[model samples]
Target: MPEQTTAAQTARADIPADGAGKPDAVVVRDALGVGIAVGLSGFAFGVTSAGSGLTVWQTCALSLLVFTGASQFALVGALAAGGNPLTAAAGAFFLGVRNAFYGLRLSQLLALPRVLRPFAAHWVIDETTAVSLAQPGRRAARIGFAVTGLSLYLLWNLTTLVGALGAEAIGDTDAWGLDAAGPAVFLALLAPMLKTGVDRAVAGLAVLLGLGLLPFLPAGVPVLLAALAAPAVLYVAGRRRGAGRGGTR
Candidate 1:
């Protein structure tokens, strides 16, 4: 009996704990939560865009064509401030550059077929990346990415229409605290993924860099600079590990 008990205990120890069942459903739930949160921010964007002298159609076109929140905001904000068109576009373009990095990471995570990859590039934003990476496996990641991308695209456009049509009636959305919803929702979705010390460290450094640069740089440009925090942290960490290995031993 004692020998049998010892063998069973050893077997149980070797069997790894399985991930939660119903991973697809879990992915959908998380993706939807984040998608809705981020998408609804389009209300603020619409109001701001219209207030900046863009017609409703023009505002909608920006959302449709640009499909990038920070860039859209930067464009409208710059125009409203009477800044040069070229300068506004430069800032917006830099902000969107981070999406290229996201695409590289997601190309591995998603493994979508060649036919779909081009369309998928439109979905490679911060929110989609966060939700997809939070999933346990490839299937869940793809499902999460698809759900987030599709849901956000639909809701954002719809809300943009609503906000544009009622821009006068909506008054100041800032009064309603809608402006913070995007970041607040994003942090909630991202909190679970910051499980490792490295993740937390990178995030902390990013926050510091972003905030420090915000005062000196244009709105979109600071965010672009802040995106460097990831590669900077990784490079320093790699160098430290190599040093610890004593010149490749």
Candidate 2:
């Protein structure tokens, strides 16, 4: 609930102004709603994580501090299946690779100090990065991203206790579609990013590739393949469009 005045100067003064487009309270409210809405995915993750042998404290800490759904899921899944610590760590890290790409994309928009970079980097997970980059104004984007991230982090960690205690009664996650909740959240967030036909088509290609590869690939490999394929297809499509325009010109 930062004021629209010089509050920007306190922690985020380095964020460059964009043509007098400052963030309003309404934008912050919408961003908060987005965070709360997307946080349903965390409930699924929490139940899964706790049921997989993670203590309530562990699940809460990871959700609050780490704040990445896929990574937490991978960690819990690996450990539950009796994976060694090394294997579990590896699985978690692999799932976390996408966040590094998010960092690279968002680093351009951030102008914070070296000390702040660590926290900022930690906060820039998939949802935050998507919301920030998708927003229209820089201030609004920053506010949206920060508020969404903070709100989710708090709520997610708090909800893990309920999940850990309640998962037994809840029974099989697959039957309840909780397993699909995470992907549904991703799709919900993705809707805003698909503003153009090319974006939509690329997403379609990725889904098709994911479904196609699920049978042949190992547990996590199909997602990795789809991740690589979707971007490459989009890049090639963009180049073709550019080439066509050049020929016409």
Per-prediction backbone clash count = 0, 0
TM-score of each: 0.70, 0.73
Local accuracy of candidate 2 as per-residue lDDT tens digits, 133-196: 7666566777777898888777766666677667888987556756556656666766887888
Which ranges in model 1 have alpha carbons more than 4 Å from their true place?
A: 1-20, 172-249
The alpha-carbon lDDT assigned to residue 135 of candidate 2 equals 67
lDDT (Cα, tens digit) per residue for candidate 1, span 1-249: 445566545544532233345467778898998889789889888887777678999989988878888778767776766666776787778867868988987887676899999999998988898877677666778888999999999899888888788888877755665445445655675688799877998899988987898677655565567668889999989989989899778
Q: Candidate 1: how large is its RMSD? A: 8.3
lDDT for position 235 in model 2: 86
lDDT of all predictions: 0.78, 0.71
